[model samples]
Target: MTRHGEDIGRWLATQRRDWDRLNEEQQARLGKLGVKKAARARKAPAKAATASRQGKGGEAFQKGLEALTQYLARESRMPGRAAVQEMPDGDIRRVGVWLANQKQRRDRLHPDQLAALAHLGADWAR
Candidate 1:
């Protein structure tokens, strides 16, 4: 006779196709036979979580900008240079260059970054 495992595997292949077409109540019936309903797919987080995450991201970006500002002020004696050299992290240096290229100090940051700065109650303009 055929092995039980092989029989179950064969049965599952056929059942899986029908599983997709089955209604919730029909799918529940299959659970009694040791066939679980397929786990529901994962979904994106709710709007509140997204907003909270963005808020946190903005705070982090602002902190990085502030630190870069302080480092440039102390080491380079210039806040806005077209190119910054010899910084440890390349990303930080790139941000410094971008900041330096800004025509106005207030225009240095992205809108999201500005929003984040405001959210943290920081007045960088002073």
Candidate 2:
């Protein structure tokens, strides 16, 4: 079988057993064939897939997911909501760690001050 066919064969195997059994040459063949097949599959619906993939750029993804809607009077344009939603837990904790480190740099922070600054953010060697 071509590389793509080998990949399908490997996937069809029970518990990845077939993958473990393939020689390096066979694995390469499978990869080539699998990629060709994937290309063909993607070619048929490329536009929509491209459009969506373009949206998944991590921090760049606008994810305009709104927090709320509010009424605006004729005299006043609706102002953006002032209430900030809770930041992602991971980001909140990471920022805390970064701040702690920054405060401890001896040039930035004295050795005597490190222990007190430790929990504030970045770790500075005393």
Candidate 3:
């Protein structure tokens, strides 16, 4: 069962399409097997809310997933907890600037992020 799960995970992580996670060609082939993708989804793997979002595009994703997870977790949170990272270099830079501009070491966070940071104050200080 674990191996079957791994196979499914592996297949989903190397998608190449820009807007659609599984390309039209692959969907057509799968459709022949009577497993057509639901029309409700047209966005790519990056847009999907699953493990594929953590693995698509290879090593970079894994490294990023690690760093953000490490940064956001509270000591009491379990290792497998989900994390929402503030990625995109531009965004990170913007956040840094915002943080710096606020002058108060604890100010300038997005409301939700501020709440999260408060919840993990011990981790943040470290």
Candidate 4:
């Protein structure tokens, strides 16, 4: 089911994952909906999933870095939010949109990712 265009399944999954952080009233409300807290014994698997996701994030960051570097090499400056770059492998990456997203999500970025962006002269990354 969906609410406000967001999938209830995904929302419930998040709620389960963060169940321990929820207030008593919130937990009770979810309990009424038949949602239970995440299993404590499952933490090891959760950590493994997080590691897998971080690995993928690292790969994506590398691709974004490649796109940005290629753009900079050709243009001598960062691309604007509307700029798109054709990667060497023929993949068209929206480098500008990626950069803009990075800036907006800078606070959530890994320290290494932020460092890479800062090294590339993205002031917002700092």
Per-residue lDDT tens digits for candidate 3, residues 1-126, read 237457653443323222266778887776576664434434344234332333443343334334444544523352232333355453332222332332244322233343444444424422
* Candidate that scores best on TM-score: 4
The better candidate by lDDT, 1 or 2, is 1
RMSD of each: 17.3, 20.1, 17.0, 6.7
lDDT of 1 by residue, 30-81 (tens): 8777786455433234323434565765465555566555565566544445
Candidate 4 C-alpha error for residue 82, in Å: 0.8
Answer with 2 or 4, whichever has the higher TM-score: 4
The better candidate by lDDT, 1 or 4, is 4
Candidate with top lDDT is 4
lDDT of 2 by residue, 34-106 (tens): 5222212233354344335545431221221111111122113322333232333422122222333344323
Question: What's the TM for model 3?
Answer: 0.22
Winner of 1 and 4 under TM-score: 4
TM-score (all chains, Cα) for each model: 0.27, 0.17, 0.22, 0.57
Candidate lDDT (C-alpha), each: 0.52, 0.35, 0.40, 0.83
For model 2, what is the error of residue 36's alpha carbon versus the real structure, in angstroms, after optimal superposition? 9.1
Stretch of 10 with least lDDT, candidate 3: 93-102
Ranking by TM-score: 4, 1, 3, 2
The local distance difference test score of model 1 is: 0.52
